[model samples]
Target: MLKIVYPICCGIDVHKNFVVATIATTDRENITTYRTKRFSTFTKDLRALALWLSNNQCVHICIESTGKYWIPIHNILEPSCQITLAHPKYVKAIRGKKTDKKDSIWIADLHKHGLVPGSFIPPADIREIRDLLRYRSKLVSFASSEKNRVQNSLTVSNIMLSSVVSDTFGKSALAILSHLLKHPDDQDFDFRPLLHGSMLKKQNDIALAIDGTINDIQAVKITLCLSHMDDIKRSYVARGTAF
Candidate 1:
């Protein structure tokens, strides 16, 4: 059971472009070092890395998670080998001069002594849900950005729609604002939606806010972005399908 419980271990210092690895033998006397190779986080790269680590007889591995950058590598290696995802904030090194190679070596040394503590790595299905949430967050951000751009365009053209209306994207605001963008004439500022609660007893201010002419090119760009945001939302709803 001694051989089964304790086996060869590796420590990896992962970065955006390359990975630094160190291999250590667990026998009481003989310690080995191999840190000259570099591996990528791509699928092919990870498969090669797993093969190499297997060849070297590394039973377990440790890595510091740097945001979303570490997940792909962890996912690739976790199925076939034992991997501990170390938290960067939890496992900080001494604040002095340090290089990538030296950091990798230090991590390996710590693992040999059973000193490093790892954070949680959820099951595969939970991980997939997390990824979907992450993508949905980006889509929400894109939608907000496009709305801000449209509001800024109106502001630039002397339209104070945001000042008079609670939401410049509301029914009354969109009715007038869309008309103005389609036709730059001030008369195109029709407040027909003000017949409903959108007016909110502020018909005059709502009409005043809709009188401006934006650059045609800027309007075109904002429209395309709005269209793209719609596409993103639809794609997210159909998440489980293969791309």
Candidate 2:
């Protein structure tokens, strides 16, 4: 027979709206008893669950990592319980006979015999940093997408600014683009004043590039893309400052 590890332990089957918990208590006779309960995912009910576990003296707790549903429960019980977060595959219930109560009971029985292997959870501060970095990465991706949209708008509008400049979003390119956007109808306007440093040498090529016409619809699309890119840049900077 498997040796008893945690003589008294609890297992929680977490869900988005509710959770099923089972507490297993083993006696000197090697027989185990289970008390199962259902609780909502709300903060108050989770606190109540923590209190119930404390009352039963079940400090060792095991739970399956079901998406992000288990985070709130972990946050509520971390202070008083030694939580063991296991992958669902490690404690999954029998197929075709699966139920929340049965899942919790199975988890509790496994944990009672030290059969559950816990996943590695970083410290709270490290998790916070990880979340911030992930959000920043998403912002970067969004900004890149907006930039691509702007490039597509320019290309479809017959503007070839990208062919003449190394970075179409550079200061000199932006100046020329702003000028072209402001005067969509007048292509003969001198662009020399907009050129900077090495861009001055490409005045003739830049002029040929900006000679393309932009329709009202393309102009609006490009404007919106630029505005969204600017907003994303500001948000990224603000989040970096916070970090």
Candidate 3:
């Protein structure tokens, strides 16, 4: 027989709208009693559940980490209970039936036998920092995608901007492209005026690179990509500042 690590423990099957909880208790005679309850995933209901658990003298609680749904519940019960954030795969129903109640009971039984392995849950402040970092990472990825789109647009127009400049999205390249986009039909366009710093040395090459057939459609797409990149950059800076 498996030893009971926790003689009295509760298991919670978390969902988006509700949670199913099962409380199990084992006596000196090795007799076990199980009681189940359902609670809505609301603040009031969660508080009631906490009260019920407290009344039963149950402090050990095992909860399945189901997406973002478990965070709020964990927040509500963290102070009162010894919470174990278990992975759902580790608490799967290996026998009889598969229902919310059954899942909760199974988890409680597993916790009783010390079979539930808890997942790592960082402190609240660390979790907030992690969320901000993840958001910033996504923004950075989107900005890179937009940069690639801009480069691809330039390539499609037979523009050798990227081949000439180390970064096609650099300030010098953008200034040249802006001039070319504005005066698409100016065959005798003087690009020396847009060349700045070391770019002045490559005046002839920059002129040759800008000489491309960028039609109205390609120009519009390129403008949109640049605009989106600007917006992403602004957001990235703002998020970094927020951190």
Candidate 4:
């Protein structure tokens, strides 16, 4: 019987614009360093990488999980071969010169010697859902910021709407603002409807609040901000439909 050796194992160092690849062949017990390849963050580049690794008979790939940066490449390379994602926080550079090319090589060397530790990699579906949730959360944050801008505009224009209404987007408040947007100086805005419990007692103040100078520009800004909230709400609905 004859002895046979298997394929080489690879380590990849990923940067925003390029990646460095290193291959360790079992037969020679030596590392083969390849030239650096520059690639945009795109599916085509990743697919090309998969093809190259396959051509070189590389079976294992190790990469540092720099950020969400690693996921796209990780997903692409996974089915073609075994992949290990390293946590950069744990993989510190040696006390010397550090560059993307060198870092990639260093990471590959550690992986080749089985000295590197890989972090937890979530299943594909879980990672995707988490990304969507994060996006939705950011949209909600943007909506909140718009709401504050509207409140500040109203305050600047001497409208005391916030003092009585818990939310500027409440049924009565929106109705009033919607009317105000179209008719910036709509004096017929019914102040009585906005009053609640003891707020009814402050009818005088409520009337005075509305009685303040309603600047035309401030009114337009508030309406636009509120309209943006509507758009954000619609996006949230679309996100729910996607899941």
- Whichever of 2 and 3 has more lDDT, that candidate is 2
Q: Stretches of candidate 1 above 4 Å error?
A: 1-7, 15-20, 28-45, 51-57, 66-69, 87-103, 186-190, 193-201, 215-218, 221-225, 232-243
- The true-versus-predicted C-alpha distance at residue 142 of model 4, in Å, is 0.8
Cα RMSD of all models vs. native, in order, equals 4.7, 1.3, 1.7, 4.7
Candidate 2 lDDT over residue span 155-207, tens digit each: 99888999999999999999888888888877898778877889989988887
- Count backbone overlaps in model 1: 0
Worst 10 residues of 3 by lDDT: 234-243
TM-score for model 1? 0.71
Tell me the tens digit of each residue's lDDT in model 1 across 161-198: 78987887776667776676667655654456444584
Q: What lDDT would candidate 1 get against the real structure?
A: 0.73
Per-residue lDDT value at 105 in model 1: 69
Candidate 3 has an lDDT of 0.88
| Clash statistics: count for each candidate | 0, 0, 0, 0
Candidate of highest TM-score = 2
Candidate 3's TM-score: 0.93
lDDT of 3 by residue, 1-243 (tens): 989899999999999999999999999877889999999999999999999999999999999999989988998999999999998899988876589998999999999999988998888889888998888788889888988888888888889888778878778888878876888887567777666678778877777777778899989988998899889878757766774
lDDT of 4 by residue, 1-243 (tens): 222223366767777666666665545534355544445558888888888788888867888887667777888888888888887765667878787777766665667666667777778888888888888888889999999999899888777877766766777667666666677666766756754565567676556656556587887788789889999988777767763
Candidate 4, residue 46: the lDDT equals 84
**Which of 1 and 4 is ahead in lDDT?**
1
